[model samples]
Target: MKDTGRFFTVGLVAAWYSSNIGVLLLNKYLLSSYGFKYPVFLTMCHMTACSLLSYIAIAWMKMVPMQTIRSRVQFFKISALSLIFCASVVSGNISLKYLPVSFNQAIGATTPFFTAVFAYLMTFKREAWLTYISLIPVVTGVIIASGGEPSFQLFGFIMCVGATAARALKSVLQGILLSSEGEKLNSMNLLLYMAPVAVIFLLPAALVMEENVVGITIALARDDIKIVWYLIFNSALSYFVNLTNFLVTKHTSALTLQVLGNAKGAVAVVVSILIFRNPVSVTGMLGYSLTVIGVVLYSEAKKRSK
Candidate 1:
């Protein structure tokens, strides 16, 4: 039984890493290399895929008991979260078009700093002094990495930072809005609800912001059916990313998830640099290392405080 459990945990971790990294690389490929410059539309597709898959997993497969919004207030709360989710995902995708994955991952490593800031502002939650101090390296590391980055774009950097901040905001807001026992939903159920709402929010935005995107995508599909397959695979991987994330958290602990996430970002940076053949400077590597070390310190501080 112990061996089986160990294997299961390892498998979950592997899936989580693969799905997370795969979705990111695919997003980079589609948005940048493939010239599919329709981030809103692409994000909508991801939400649609997530919505359908989550419904199937929960309702049909009975992955977990079905959950429903009990009141209008709860529905609206979920809608707000979905809006933030849309912004985070779309901006991240847009950034990929202009930035290398290695630099983007380096920037993304600062999520904990933004999370801490949002948590304090929104909920007035306070952490230990050590916890607060640990963020210094996280912020400083990103600054160093940004300075050393060889292929930096101002717009892309701004979008990436915005995406990271929005992601942190969503995490903080989710805790605040869903604190009630009656309103709380499991991760899968939350995704099932939030994904559809995200699609609804993104549809009009995609249509208006990305002129003739649908036509262009269709043209691309007609020219080469492989693009369609790539999109379908990419969207499927997006759903898997969320699913595996939840599974890993459920089977392990949140701290373990955080640790794995930090390592995954590093692995992604190395893999992306190799795959994309992006130029890297020693200073940039030092900065990313500093940021990662800061994140590790932050995690340790949080664990000790708890």
Candidate 2:
């Protein structure tokens, strides 16, 4: 039993990287080749699948209702958070359409900064000294990481920028809403609800904002195994990561867990380059290094503040 649990946890961590990094690269391709609209649609499809699969597993195993979310106010808040994330996904996906995976991931290093700012503004009166200062290096590193190449695609840049914002806001909101107890309040249960809510919200937005829906449907009908694998892996990976993240944080220190999560993203960037053979220049390496340092600094600063 002990060995089984240990193996399960190990599998969870490995799966986290596999699924998450998979989603990141897959979204990049879908965005670049198909369009942003396709990625958003794919997100919806993936989420719907995740929700169903999770619910089925819960039923099959007969785990005590893990933790179902309730409370109109809390659900509303979560749903709103989901909507913001939905928009963020759309923006990030579209950005990929117009950019290289390397550049896209490099630019995405800003998410930690955004998260810090959001956290400070919403709850804390201020960030710790190092946390605040870490922003400069992190931002600078992102600049250097891309070898100082800017995401010049006007619309894609805007979309990704929005995505960054959504990512920040959603994290904070999840922290807040997840505080309330529901009938079932585990990670799987929460995502089970959130995914559908997000998909429902995105359906209208996709219909209004993107004409790529028809194109995506046609592509799917043509039996693009690449697209299918990407979607499946992305969705599955996302669900596992979210669940593991929730469980790990509860078991370990939030800061430690978060730091690991941050480091994982950085590693994922390298893995993407290695696997996809995306361009990685000297400047980009420096930027990536600086970003790691900034994150470390930020973590230290935050620990002191606590």
Q: TM per model? A: 0.99, 0.83
- Displacement of residue 182 (Cα, Å) in model 1 is 0.1
lDDT string for model 2 (1-306, tens) is 988877876666676667677777777766664443466676676667767766775667654365545568777876887788777777777787776666666567678788877888888857667678878897888766545544345576667667877888887877866664453366666676778888788777667666768576767757765656666667776666665666666655677676777777777777767766755677767787787787777777878888
Backbone clashes for every candidate come to: 0, 8
RMSD of each: 0.7, 3.2
Q: lDDT of each structure?
A: 0.94, 0.70
Candidate 2: regions farther than 4 A off:
1-8, 33-37, 62-64, 150-154, 177-184, 212-216, 223-230, 250-252
lDDT of 1 by residue, 10-107 (tens): 99999988998999999999998888899999999999999999989999999889988999999999999999999999999999999999999988
Q: Residue 97, candidate 2: how far off, in angstroms?
A: 1.5
What's the residue-level lDDT of 111 in candidate 1? 95
